[model samples]
Target: MRSSLHVLYLSLANLLITLSITLPSPVQTAGTVLVRRSDDGMWHPERYGGGAPKVNNPPSPGPALAASTIHPIPSPTLLEATGLIPFSAPLETTHPIPSSLPVEPKEPLRTIKEPEPHESPLISADKFNKAMTAANFPVPSSEQHVAFVASTKKAKITSALEAAMYLAHLLWESHGLQEVVERACVNSACPGSYISDLDVKGKRYFGRGYIQLTWAKNYLEASKGIYEDDRLLQHPEMVSENSTVSWETAAWYWGAKVHDAAASGNFGRTTAEINGPLECRGGWSGAEAARSRFRLFTTIAPIFGAPGPFLEAGCY
Candidate 1:
């Protein structure tokens, strides 16, 4: 009897191990395996001859799903169409099943600010006057306007800002009224001998034109810059006789040397360019003239669409 019992126990142990390997992992609803110590000291499937329900094959994993940022709950219509739930069941209500869907928290929307549009480089004569008035500079005359537009066009002063600054300089120079003819020099005896090379036998070349192209040499140089001619040196009154000649000579000075000063919007620098060393030189008169020019720059800045002539206007 002892030998028989040992054989039966061994057999039972073998069966249990074989059953565990064949079956899938035990799940919550799946029935549990049972055992009984036989009277003969042997074990089989179970006391009543029952075992885990026979499974032909393990369940296959479905196709992999792509990950998503916003996890959308499956709509009831989708589940119904797929026959996931009972056909007799009611459709999805406004309220969702708590366990069926994830609670997606909302995020705030973002926005951005845009910059405002700016003005163009150039403006019309009408607009130019309006801007000058806004800056407290008086409007130019019709004749002054004609001369300004004509001369500046020739000098490549295309922008309204450029025209405005050029007009401002002319205003201060001769108040838009220049004596184009050569006049008496600082000294009566030195009528036209400002430059030794200009002191010709029968010629008088003193201050003339808008900004006054003075000295015999200046007349010669200015005519070359104006129209590439030297007749102005011999007959200097041609600048006064011809309106175009007068404006052209002035434009030549502006485009040649004083253009950069105007670009800076510093009237003092432009003034210094016109009258050497007088801007921040000499005595009281020189100092006063310099101050006045600096102020003019600030005042005319707005006409050119500048924020202001608030930049440093010192001699440098």
Candidate 2:
């Protein structure tokens, strides 16, 4: 009975050893990979499986994704067309996406304040009336006086001398601001065919405005400078018909061409600017007119309190 019992124990021990060698692990039988906790504290596929799951052991990394294989989200237009989003609705996102469109920088506009009615300076009404009386010019209406002051200011006639010189020219050309349009001869002897196109409309560019602005080209240029268009060319009579337009055109011409020469106190130089071909050259046909202009300048200068012994008036 003892020998039989001993034999059974020996046999039982041998059977246990064989079972342990031949039987598969629970995970292996389930066909699942053994997982270990990584440094990030997450469970991942283990390097090898035999003992308990590791705390920090991690598997080798897989192949990386290619740049070409990556895709971006559809454009707003495409998404709207496909009915993914309502038309004109703003796109929603987890993160605020930066705009790819270029932003244009805008320039700030400059503003100029308009002057008040009584804001006349340098060329005051009392002084102008005195000057007109002294020059034997016709007494201008109150409206005419105001218009003259405004026009001078627009021409940037800051000094008394500039005012006197400008007035002298206007007095000579416009006949003391009485005749806005030139008194041209009716016959073919008069200056009418300056620009053939202007004559087609019966628009004579002989002489008009305060400085007697002549020629179609001058009218066109002044129109562009003042109105920023060719309206003056089309309606040449506006230079004489519209007082504001007339005065502004003269002011534009003075500021652009004659102001600098007048500032030099050289009467003849200013004459040359107005009619160089006719009056400036020695022994020219309009030498008499040049002398007349000089006389007017000398006469008006003292009235406006301009300091003299001025330069002798001649083209040279």
Best candidate (score: lDDT) = 2
Best candidate according to TM-score: 2
Q: On residues 1-316, what C-alpha lDDT tens digit does candidate 1 reach at each position?
A: 9999987877776556446643422221112233323344333232111222222221122122222122233455554455444222122333333333233467766666676775443545665566456546567566656666667766667654566566666555554354454345534634525656556676666666777777777778887886687888878877767877788888888888778776775555666677756556666787777666455555665656655535435353
Task: Give the per-residue lDDT digits (tens) of candidate 2, residues 93-181.
Answer: 33443333223467777687876676546766787888888889877788877888888877878888878888888888888888777
lDDT of 2 at 179: 77
Error of 1 at 77 (Å): 82
Residue runs of model 1 more than 4 Å from their true location after superposition: 1-123, 127-141, 158-161, 178-195, 310-316
Q: For candidate 2, what's the RMSD?
A: 17.7
How does each model score on TM-score?
0.51, 0.58
Please give the CA lDDT of all the candidate structures: 0.57, 0.68
